[model samples]
Target: MVAIELKIGSFKAEYAGKMNLYLSLLDRFERGENENQSIGIILCADKDHLDVEIALQDINKPIGVAEYQLLLSKEELQTLVVNEIKASTKEEG
Candidate 1:
């Protein structure tokens, strides 16, 4: 069994605490339901590597932290398209 937590902003200590508790609870209640040991994953928009390290140092559970990417904003997409068009035009000329 696996538990995944998504965070919009950044990694924090409290998140680790919550994950620890949740994993512990799952172990207690969902025992024998999952063949393998339960795992937790934290997906955040942005995270500080050091902060995540310190947050999970004391905990005795399996947890992983990773970052996720959001779709580009309208303005950013438009800018990229415009740049591509300009570059193409220059190459053709």
Candidate 2:
């Protein structure tokens, strides 16, 4: 299982704590006995790499933080998807 949290602004230290809580809950209640541990992904509109690094340094969970863009036009979005598909096909080949 993967838990995702989306934020509109920059990354905050508290976000990591929130995600940790989510992962814990999922592991306790939702995860199956044979399943692997839950993972977490935090997506923010902007983030500082150093801040994210520090925030997750001491944590043992499989969590990751990434930035997202909201300003892409429809054409740009389509192009990106197409390119990603092409890249993935090449890898599979």
Candidate 3:
């Protein structure tokens, strides 16, 4: 099983905003220090790109928006991509 960090601040934030934040955090988390097989989000009232920056102004950690699930890890996705590329190359060749 995977882990998720859900952050909620307001209602307007919605799930879409949370997903975007998840992707952004995932990128950072992948390189930064942390356990694998876990995900996060950053919730807020609005997601104006700048809003997210401000909301995450001075905070950091395995955080998520709201209504969460155990999403796959970056390494897992990368491995899948590499495998797909290899398979495609082999098929073409």
- On lDDT, the leading prediction is 2
Error of 2 at 20 (Å): 0.6
Name model 1 segments beyond 4 Å from true: 72-93
In candidate 2, what are the lDDT values of residues 1-93, reduced to their tens digit?
999998979999999989999999999999999999999999998999999999999888999999998788878988999999999999999
Clashing pairs in model 1, backbone N/Cα/C closer than 3 A: none
For model 1, give the RMSD to the true fold. 10.4
| List of clashing residue pairs for candidate 2 | none
Compute the lDDT for candidate 3. 0.51
Per residue, candidate 3 scores C-alpha lDDT tens digits across 25-49 of: 5565664455453444443433456
lDDT of 1 by residue, 1-93 (tens): 798999978888899999988888888888586466779999998999999999999998999999988799868979998999999999999
TM-score attained by model 3: 0.28
**Colliding residue pairs in candidate 3:** 5-64, 7-64, 7-65, 40-64, 41-63, 41-64, 41-65
User: How does candidate 1 score on lDDT?
Assistant: 0.89
Q: Using TM-score as the measure, which candidate wins?
A: 2
Q: lDDT score of model 2?
A: 0.94
